[model samples]
Target: MHIKEFFSPDHTRLSFEIFPPNQRMSLKAVMASAARMAAYEPDFMSVTFKADGSGGDQTIQISNAVSEVMGIPSIAHLTCSGIPKTELPAVYDELTENKVKNILVLGGDSTRELGEDAYLPYAKDMVAYFRERGDFTIGAACFPEGNDPALSMDEELRHLKEKVGMGVDFLTTQMFFDNEVFYRFLEKARTMGIDVPILAGIMPITSAGQVRRIKDLSDAALPDSLLRMVDRFKDDPDAMFDAGLTFAENQMADLVAAGVSGIHVYTMNKPAIPERIVRDLGRLFHA
Candidate 1:
């Protein structure tokens, strides 16, 4: 099913993002965990593409299993960083053979040095390519806090408008800890005429290491309240987990109360994370 059809003005939808396991982990084990997550009956599940594109085969396999075997719609991430344009036909054939209907186009971390002729340098390029390639539903990423710290908000919004104009069906945001930041972004996007449904990405930071990684990766604004809680419980594993989960619960509750289009949890391949979220926000999701 096209993910766009899941969005409604009256109801907020729930979705989960899972990644392909590394070489040491067996596909069967990840599928088992996916089965557990599927029991919650989320609107859909998205399988992430590896940064270097080494796990492209596994991504396809997992997405196929999640959709065909688990009986849920799946959005397979297709990255343009390491993959060559010449190789796209085979990948598209695989997705078609597997009956996958949705794709999230991204320009993931480059595994090799790129020159001027790089296949698809930006996510927008891939979105346009996919739109012309087939009849699949396409998704693209957005940054509520701004993807590049150097780019002005006007420049960022201009680029985002161009991307959505290139036939993007919807957008999933990079995770942010503050709802107000997202609200401001939504207002700007609406005012700019980018009216597609935007799913708010929520990542539950269960460990101090994740906090450090988040700081290094994106310009996601972490609230002082959350940082204080993490600093207080960084040394204690159990306490840190509880604090992180509760923080995510409260954040999601606020987003739901505000009637956001949808919530996409970056599961990090952990079923327990979304399990707790579903348990705490049960009525919000059902409402």
Candidate 2:
């Protein structure tokens, strides 16, 4: 199903994300997890594009398994960074052949230097390119806290509007700890007239090391309360995992109450976390 059709103003949506497994052994484990996630029947599921060379083919294969085999709507992520401009058409062809209809276009890790011959320089161009091709429902990434430091907030909003104008069907946020940040972002996006449905991206922090990794990756400011929880449980893995899940549960509950378009769990390929969260939600949405 095209994800755009799922975004009705009358009901909130729920989705989960997982990545393509690189190894043959890991593929079995991930497929098992995918089946577990599918049992909950989220409105949709998304698979991330890996930077590894085979990410393109693997993305199509796994996405087909989830969508065609498991009977769930799936979104395949596409990244233009580090990949040759000439490679994407074949990737798109494979996805279409597999009947994958939803896509999330991303401007991958900024730290990775782009090659001189990269075709789609920005996510907007990628969105435009796929849009002109005309069959898929396209999604673009948004950072609720803000994106690259080099770009001012005004500049970022302008580019976001431009991307939507170029043909993004919806936006999914980068994972954030605070719901207020997402609300503020929504307000600003609406003020700027970029009105497509926005999905709240969430990651359940299940370990002490993940704290450092999130900080290193997104530079999102850790609130004092969250920091204190981290300090209190940092040494106990079991306790820390429980605390992290609690925090995510609370964050998601509040977002659901606020009526966000969708709650997208960055499951990190851990089916248990999303399974627990979905059970807690307990028929909150028609989806």
Judging by TM-score against the true structure, name the best candidate.
1
lDDT of 2 at 95: 75
Please write out the lDDT profile of model 2 over residues 1-287, one tens digit for every residue.
89899887767788999887765437788789888999889888998887344545577788888889999999989887734578778877887898989989998753344565555688887888888885999999998878879988778999999999999999999999988988998999999999999999988888778889888789576778788898999899888878988998898878878889998998878888877877777577763
- Per-model TM values vs. the true structure: 0.95, 0.94
Scored by CA lDDT, what does every candidate get?
A: 0.87, 0.84
> Candidate 1 — what's its lDDT?
0.87
Clash pairs, model 2 backbone: none
Best by lDDT: 1
- In the range 1-287, model 1's lDDT, one tens digit per residue, is 77878889888889999877766556777788899999888999999887334666778778889988898899999888756777788888988888888999887775745554757778888888778888888998999988777898778988999999998988999999999999999999999999999999999988889988899888998889989999999999899988999999898999999998899999887899878888888789897
